[model samples]
Target: MSLPENFNGWEHLQKTYMLEYNRRVDKFFSDVQGNGDLSNVRSSLKLACRLVDGDNEATWSLRTSLFFDVIGYSRKNLSIFYGSNIDTALPVAGHPQLFLYFSQDSQAVPLNGKRLDHEKSCRLTRYACKSGQSLPAVTKANLLDIAHEIKAQFVSGGKGIIYTAGKLSVSYTDPANGFPKGTRWLVNSKSEAIELYGKLCNVIDRPFDINKMNVNTPEKDSTTQVINTTDTILGKQYKQYAYRPVANLRFRYAYVSFGGSASPIFLIDTTFRNTALIA
Candidate 1:
């Protein structure tokens, strides 16, 4: 049967959401086509993605409010899936947002467009998976090679390849990995991740250790070089006068498969107020 007119890809994210949400998603997807991270869009497209995003509230919201009038699929006989920790072969989290599968038995995997893209990323990363326990550096082109190895897994593998765009004049051989080819690396945070494409171009033909280039992987594990806020992302010095000391700060890190990873660094984990100290 055909999907409802209103209930469609990015058309209807949640069942009970406001009518204006459709407009928001439409604008979001269209604008997201440009660059940066489109993680939120992935959650809206498929149930698997949504589950990985941990949007359980939305599930109840759909059942009660998103009646068939909008999305017939939501009320279909088919069971909706949101992976769990038991799923091993499947990455811990759905690609892009780092979601884990939850089911005990293997059912038909969702082969949607975004899933295909994520699978492509996983394939290349797996193929390049070497003897080293540590993560390796990679480029966009070489990632394609890895993707080619497991093309069938990706629904759109044969149709097209993933692309990354930026204004920093950034480019990478295996741009898929965001790192350049033959470069040893590790991805530790988002800031360094942002530099991957540009760095790849700089190291165009140089042969380097893949492990050395890992974004989040620390050098030799003992590398406790604290990231200073004033200088880099982790530096506590970053919160000078812009944000009040009591205000929570946003902390961000980059994951290899997922575009941008973030967390909220509260100013104080505990709170103590002594009125006596004041005046």
Candidate 2:
């Protein structure tokens, strides 16, 4: 089916995708059951349904591709459908798509003992697709190809938490300009904000103090605002300065798992919103 030219909101779009995905899954299972391969049909059906539910429109195409791929692989590897170990065997035997999905869906713990945060597994799946690598090959390679790249890009050395791209508006108090408000340095990305923060720290003789606070609001509207305040004393005179971040810094981690073991893989990508700096 096709969407209407005036398709209104995301709710409608999501419902359409959900309906189509369910129809495809139901038909696929019915056809499989009719073929007399009734072995572990219930288990297979349950897993197949998971591909659609709880997923968004962005991953719909990839999940559809994975669904058909699983069917094709299962046909070639018939032994996976039978026996007492069918439940376990079917996922890892020759079905990389299923294995990847299970791994990405499960929770993972890093060395810090904190649950990693990030976007849905679809982000990594899309990343893998963009690299032109087959999911089966990535699975067989223990997912290192994607894992290594993700770590290089997102993870901070000695800091277990992942750093996702975010927009930040930092404004510092500048009394010399006769402005009551702080001079703002609007940065587009987290990396750029950090770089600017480092530069600010260098100019002062004493260490710049960093204070972080969580805004008290609804979870969906919650944001982390970091304040950097510095007190510099020159002879008898002292200057107190403060910088505040007005935008939200979303924190999340992505993980890849196989054989029940999960490892942090990547962070969700976010675009930086640009705001004009106030002098």
Candidate 3:
């Protein structure tokens, strides 16, 4: 869809863009599940290119988020590994190829101790399938190709394509209140996530520092606490410590790779404090 000429503010534009983005994401998965065809996926990618063709904050954000979505999809579904040195010499028959890799100087070192020259080798976004079947370097121009390769190598060929509903279940503590008693919100897009973060910031009268928040992955569980202090100095000094409203966002993924059980309660979760956080 074409961006509207007349719009509200950046947030409004972002919300509008996210609406379309979510629609596309849903449609992509729907098509994949419906018939395993990628024609509509290619069309959607082309439309994304058109939407993000310009050099602007909105377009840049869309492009970056779209790429991250692709990466997230791969991480959630495929059994891929990432690092500077990955053993690619040993070939496993019938096993899904590690389609993602990082190599220096467009060269990859195989387990046989041979340095193979590859023009497409990139630091983190390189895509390589079998010999003579390599895609171009991951870039905005090659997103469609990269996506197609990811599907062909990982999703198809009986490689065990895992599927999720694509909903980020979020439950955050009411910053006005304390933990163990908060609210939950289901987020389906990045814009909604940003809006939710804004709401939490408004409640606390401060910007939320995600770095300070705790995370509870599928493998492990954790907790956090918020404390306040007050001091009085007269003839002597006195101090009082109490609890304050502090929120921590947590993420939990339901993929088996993340240590999830066969049957998961939720595909993903974003909880606050003791509550489940968004992913």
TM-score computed on alpha carbons, candidate 3: 0.17
Model 2 clash pairs are 117-252, 117-253, 118-252, 118-253
Q: How would you encode candidate 2's per-residue C-alpha lDDT over 55-174 as one tens digit per residue?
A: 765566666666656545223212222113233432122222211111111112222222222221111222232224454234423445443433343334422232232234444332
User: What lDDT does each candidate get?
Assistant: 0.28, 0.34, 0.32
The clash number for model 1 is: 37
For TM-score, the strongest prediction is 2
Worst 10-residue stretch by lDDT in candidate 1? 269-278
Model 2 stretches astray by more than 4 angstroms: 1-118, 123-137, 140-142, 161-253, 257-279
Clashes of each: 37, 4, 6
- Candidate 1 wrongly placed segments (more than 4 Å): 1-19, 31-279
* Candidate 3 runs further than 4 Å off: 1-65, 68-75, 80-247, 255-279
Order of candidate numbers by lDDT, starting with the best: 2, 3, 1
Candidate 1, 159-185: lDDT as tens digits: 212222111121123434333243332
On a 0 to 100 scale, what is the lDDT of residue 107 in model 3?
A: 19
Query: What's model 2's overall lDDT?
Result: 0.34
Instruction: Score candidate 3 by lDDT.
Output: 0.32
